[model samples]
Target: VKIRVGNGRVKGVDLGYKVIECEKIVVAAGEGSKYLFQTLDIDIPIVIRRKELYVSEPYSLFIDPLIIDTREDSLGLYVTQTLRGELMGSIDYPEAIDDLTHETTLKHYTVYAKKLVRLIPIMKYSTVMRCWSGNYVTTPDNSHIMGRDPEWPEGLYISTGFSGHGFMLAPYTGFLMARHLIYGETPNTMEPYTPDRFRMGKYVRESLVIG
Candidate 1:
């Protein structure tokens, strides 16, 4: 787990360089990456937001495929079947908290779960076994931190702090980020997505339904 310098030879070094050299150094370490970036004097404030995911065992009923109820102006209770007919869901109105722990309270769970059961009726008696948490590192402007740094160390690159949309946009963002760093010629089509805009207050809001 440690990528630091070592006492013995490894990966072409008697010890990893106190300072290494590479064509590029990409910091895509997710929300937890802020601690490392601070070492390089890159001050990024990343918050830990808890998103709850549920796994439930079936009642004497059948629910097939993925049933997502995007109603009530929120991601409401989304129900999806597993290989064994178990269901998973989430309550989408994010309250925005620093509490990453997602020990589901019975009230929150019952309320959201029943919302789906009401819509479909088949899940009326399913028993939820667990609720868990995941983090979505969000930038203040709700975009990703991409592109090469203009000031600090040249050849250094940043690609962290995605505002919950990282997974959906990973491929295209990688292409654009690599092109900008490698050739200094980022496609103009994606120019507006650069992280620099956060400083200028020119923000772009995406109608990503899942959020």
Candidate 2:
């Protein structure tokens, strides 16, 4: 995918086989945003890390709210029961990798299982129905990048690098971003997350990132 910019403004996007003309563009392509921005000579401070998660077989409802185990030994493990009674969660400890691969490793599974059983003893008997791996698009400060930059091409906006909180922060961020694009005004709440913060050495540090 190529973002076609002309006259210092977004003109369209070229998707290899076809081109879609547009006046504005919002880049929210997760890990792929790095390469997408590079087409326009823009380099974002985004890093990709590998995250693994597991789900246990359905059991009688036991756990209610999500349990965040921040014990030093647990490595920020979180566990929660889904509506279907399946236990689902992941550990906050992630592995930094360069490639985009969803390959699960036995080492990760073993570590996660031991930690889960240690935190919830009853989980020792539960069978892990499945496990999967995914990528976390992170930034130095662990917060998302939103809004636009005056130095960037006009009509070009960014909303990526949520670190691990994209799903949780999407609704509010999306709303604010929409208002900023439509009204040509950046909201006070979204001011701290402009794409130029990295260059400006302004970071919004967050420490409580749990799975």
Candidate 3:
């Protein structure tokens, strides 16, 4: 992806074979967002962490609600029964590694199984049939970095560093960001989440990060 930033604004983007001009650009590429902003001399502090998920074999278990067991170490353990009767869940582990790798871990599965069985004894009879991992783009304050850049006011906008809540908060984030971009107005609720909050020493803290 080619970014074109100049004259205190974004000129356009060169999509390899094509160049599309736009009045502004919003960088929300998750973990890849860091490098994209770097082209415009903007540094966003983000770390990529891999979180693994597991799915159990289909069974006739009546687990309807999403079960979540919060802990201080692993963030929390959560599981829910899908319509197909399969148990799907994930646990937030430590940030020991940094990379965009989809590698699964036997240790993660083992711990999840133990926690699942303890939380719901019926899960002891379940067996995991699949496991996968994905990248999480996290920020220092565990909150998102949104809003226009002060230096590039006429061009760049950012909406990344969501930690692990991007999927759940997409609808709300999209609405707020769109309003900010088109109307040049931001809701007071999102003022604390501006991209330059860290630089201005006004970082907001979010503690309910459940992967």
Largest TM-score belongs to which candidate?
2
lDDT of 3 by residue, 37-73 (tens): 7776678888888899999899886887887787564
Better of 1 and 3 by lDDT: 3
Candidate 2 regions off by >4 Å?
none
Q: Residues 1-211, candidate 1, lDDT per residue (tens digit)? A: 2122223211111123353434455667886567655655566656656677788875534666666676664355666777776677777645656565655566666667667777867667667787777777776666677765465455556687677778878998888877876778868756766656666677766545343
> How big is the positional error of residue 65 in model 2, measured in Å on the Cα after superposition?
2.5
Query: Model 3 reaches what TM-score against the true structure?
Result: 0.88
> What are the clash counts of all predictions, listed in order?
0, 0, 0
Evaluate residue 69 in candidate 3 and report its C-alpha lDDT on the 0 to 100 scale: 87
RMSD of 3: 2.2
The models' CA-based lDDT, in order, is 0.64, 0.88, 0.82
Model 3: residues with Cα > 4 Å off, grouped in runs: 71-75, 94-96
Residue 140 error, candidate 2, Å = 1.1
